[model samples]
Target: MDNTGFSLASLLVVTALGLLVPLIVTRIRAVRIPIVVGEIIAGVVVGKSGFSIIQNSEWLQFLQFFGLAFLMFVSGLEIDFATLKPTKVRKGNRYARFLTMPPVFATFATGLTFVLSYSLSQVLFNLHFIKSPLLFSLILTTFDWLWFF
Candidate 1:
């Protein structure tokens, strides 16, 4: 194929690698790592940072977008919204029930996370490990929700 055109062989290779990563991860029982982590490492090895084996193409970009959307959709499906309903708190005022709601609790937890992250980031900044504590804290805080799904 021409230099500008996409190759089907490259797509096949990517697909095969994607399928093989999980199997490889499972086969090595001693080394415990998430499949997603393994896949990311494999991608880095094959991508421009390592070998430049996987050429960027329109079809690959489209597939990447679709895959991300599908992953988010599947992750969102795991949430149990029904449990988010407010529950009664005995011997408390009207606002107590509202405080018991999952969103309120989540907000409180997020705030706590930001506070902790900011403190840690401040230490890192003092040590010259990072430039901006606020930005680093924000990044760390943002990743807190990723574990939920």
Candidate 2:
């Protein structure tokens, strides 16, 4: 589009509306979900798929990167390191098992994914169906979260 598409007014209005949707949805029905979900949906609506408010601005890219970094920093800040102390604090046996379970499950999933991808790659390569194993590896890694869950 043109410079008129990325004007300050458009950005501010889109951002406000994005924030407002989740607020209004949660307030009206008394249900709760993350604000980030609303923000992502609003982004899709205002993106090329919908109204096309902003079109690939460099400033917006930079701001998105900075926002992600800031969120990670804030998450790290909230972690309670003191709770993990062995002498000063006591933890139930279940806490240790719970912590180990997620990692174990993740490890198993990663290994299974690798094995499946490798077997598929071998069969496809033998049949001349696919050009490269690297391409198959990339496809496996690019799985959508919605599909996995």
Predicted structure with the largest TM-score when compared to the true one: 1
Tens digit of per-residue lDDT, candidate 1, span 1-149: 23467868779878999899999988976767777768878989988898978887777777788878987898899899888887667876767776688899889888999999999999999999999999999999987354334
Error of 1 at 29 (Å): 5.5
Give TM-scores for every candidate, taking all chains together and pairing residue i with residue i.
0.72, 0.47
| Each prediction's RMSD to truth | 4.0, 7.1
**Local accuracy of candidate 2 as per-residue lDDT tens digits, 1-149:** 54333456555765687668877656744445456655677778887888877666555666678868987898799887655544422467865555455455556677788778878887888899888976796577555445223
Q: Name the TM-score of candidate 2.
A: 0.47
Q: Lowest lDDT 10-mer window, candidate 1?
A: 140-149
Local error of candidate 2 at residue 72 (angstroms): 3.1
Off by over 4 Å in 1: 1-3, 25-38, 92-99, 144-149
Instruction: Give residue 146's lDDT in candidate 1 (0 to 100).
Output: 46
> In model 2, what are the clashing residue pairs, if there are any?
none
